[model samples]
Target: MVPISRLTVIAATVVLIDQWSKQYIQGHMLPGMSIPVLDGIFHITYVLNPGAAFGILENQRMLFIAIALVMLGLTAYFLKHIPEPFRLMRLGLSLLAGGAIGNVIDRVQTGHVVDFFDFRIWPVFNVADIAIVTGVGCVIYTLVFSTFPTGNQENQR
Candidate 1:
């Protein structure tokens, strides 16, 4: 079984970093402000998202919060069933939980998520978003590539 301490540490790290970065952005930049990190490529643009990814369902803060909480709960419930030594799965779930909580904090406190890290081609996003997406990708990778030992297999061992 995945160790709860390890999972908690990973999640806490992500939340801390996400919150710190967002706070820094909020203190340093105004909404709609942009600072070029890479000419015409990447930038630090501060924006407040009131809805989900890609700015969809705008102004639906409560709905997004509810969804995130449910997802986090389900992830925790499933994590227990995954066999041990599955580091990637643990990391994935931890990051996912961290990111969700980070955004939830923002929604509860300000009714919006603070986003930065602009790549001119895509909608602006923040550290928490990165963690969430990365976590999901990791989870998908683990599910596709890792083989979990079944009860029968464990019994044989």
Candidate 2:
């Protein structure tokens, strides 16, 4: 399949998993509830986030939506132009788009995003948040390493 096709598949899968996991958490747990799955290292803590990551800019619905739309638009436009050599970047963009969509759905439906994953030391987050973070990490890695002749271009030295 084409790279775009692969990205689409990945993005759709992320959205599906993110949405499903959020629904499961909502159904099984209440807001502010914490379940100790690994003692103090990790926990499933339910939270309704009305802001961006780490609860920044709380209650700025319009800003969140505007940013999401712009990001998605850019992802769609750039995904078509990215060369085949940037497979990891493409994948990252896909995940980012999927995660945005998942969170947007929640925001539109309930005015907040459902979150559950907790690492005790870190802010509570959900699958969509994970996808967005992972996607950004992948993009940064590609920019810093993959595209800089550090991964598969050593033979040129």
Candidate 3:
């Protein structure tokens, strides 16, 4: 079983990073402000998203709220079923939960998500997106790379 204490630590870190980044952008960056950080390759642009990724279902605050709640619930349920040996995966999942909640809190409070990290080739996003993406990537990596060797491999070892 994963240690509850460790999971709490990971969750707290994710929440802090996500919330702090959003707050920093909201407070310091003017709405619609775009500052090119690396010529035409990277920029920091402030934006508020009222829906899901890429601003889907725009202005459907209630739908976003329900979706976030369902996601958080499903994640919590699956956390216990994840492989016991996959601590990294567990931590990653915890971060996902925390990050989702962080953004959900923002949406509930302001009816939008604060996004500011703008990539040249992609839609603008925030720290919560980074956490969620990284978390999912870790789970995928664990599934693909950490599977137990079978039959002949185990016998040979």
Using TM-score, give the best candidate's number. Answer: 1
lDDT of 1: 0.90
Model 1 earns a TM-score of 0.92
**Candidate 1 off by > 4 Å:** 150-157
Clashing pairs in 3: none
| Per-residue lDDT of model 2, residues 11-100, tens digit only | 899999999999999899999999999999999999999998889999988788888999999999989987878888888999999999
Q: How much lDDT does candidate 3 score?
A: 0.84
Candidate 3 lDDT tens digits, 1-157:
8776777788778889889888888788888999999978889999988877877899998887888799888878888777679887887788788878888889889999998888878888888888888888887888788976457876786
Q: Which runs of model 3 end up more than 4 angstroms from their true locations?
A: 148-157
TM-score of each: 0.92, 0.90, 0.86
Over 48-131, each residue of candidate 1 has an lDDT whose tens digit, in order, gives 999888899999988988999999999889778776777887888889999999999999999999999899899999888988
Candidate with the larger TM-score of 1 and 2: 1
